[model samples]
Target: MTQYEVTETSDVKGENCPMPVVKTKQTIDQLAEDDVLEVLATDSGSVSDIAGWADTTEGVELVDQEGDGDVYKHYVRKTE
Candidate 1:
């Protein structure tokens, strides 16, 4: 996985479903434009959830996603 210059990191390690995506959105909203957010999550569902959310949402981009067993890492960027 390529390293990203993340402006913030949101750890939702044990959280599941909406919590991961919800927290990601909230955190991303607080970031400056072009800032990158690194989201660490343990729930496997977050892989697809975050991607889907980013895909449909405006001003947010899903830069990258990586998974290692139960741990998942998502890099999201604030485009606006």
Candidate 2:
């Protein structure tokens, strides 16, 4: 498995729909380039929403993702 030294974390566990993605974009914007942001979310749809959002967003990279039970954790590296 890949290990990341997360510099920041956003716990949007209970948020649904655009909340997770919104928080992720907001959080990632605050991070410096190359810094890792870890996101904890309970909404399963975030798995795809975040990924897709990151895919189209600039200055953000989806480094890793994991799903455990009802929780989804994602790692994003700021590129800009």
Candidate 3:
């Protein structure tokens, strides 16, 4: 995966499933095309939720994803 510079970051740690995806969507919206948004979440469900959201969303791309300790790091890129 290409390493992307995070133009925006949203930390939804301790939040539930929907909050991670919801906050990611909001943060992604604040980014411009091709900009990367890094989301930090502790909810295990967020791994799938954010990935699914990026899959279903038209302009968001799930560029990278990994787990660090209890934190799930999701890298989403805003695309045209």
Instruction: Give all candidates' CA lDDT scores.
Output: 0.94, 0.92, 0.90
Off by over 4 Å in 1: 1-3
TM-score of each: 0.93, 0.94, 0.95
Clashing pairs in 2: none
lDDT of 1 by residue, 36-67 (tens): 99999999889999999999999999999989
Better of 1 and 2 by lDDT: 1
Shift in Å, residue 34, candidate 2 = 0.6
**Candidate 1 versus the native: TM-score?**
0.93
lDDT of 2 by residue, 1-80 (tens): 65669999999988999999999888888889989999999999999999999899989889999998999999999988
The residue ranges of model 2 lying beyond 4 angstroms of the native Cα positions read 1-3
**Candidate 3 structure lDDT:** 0.90
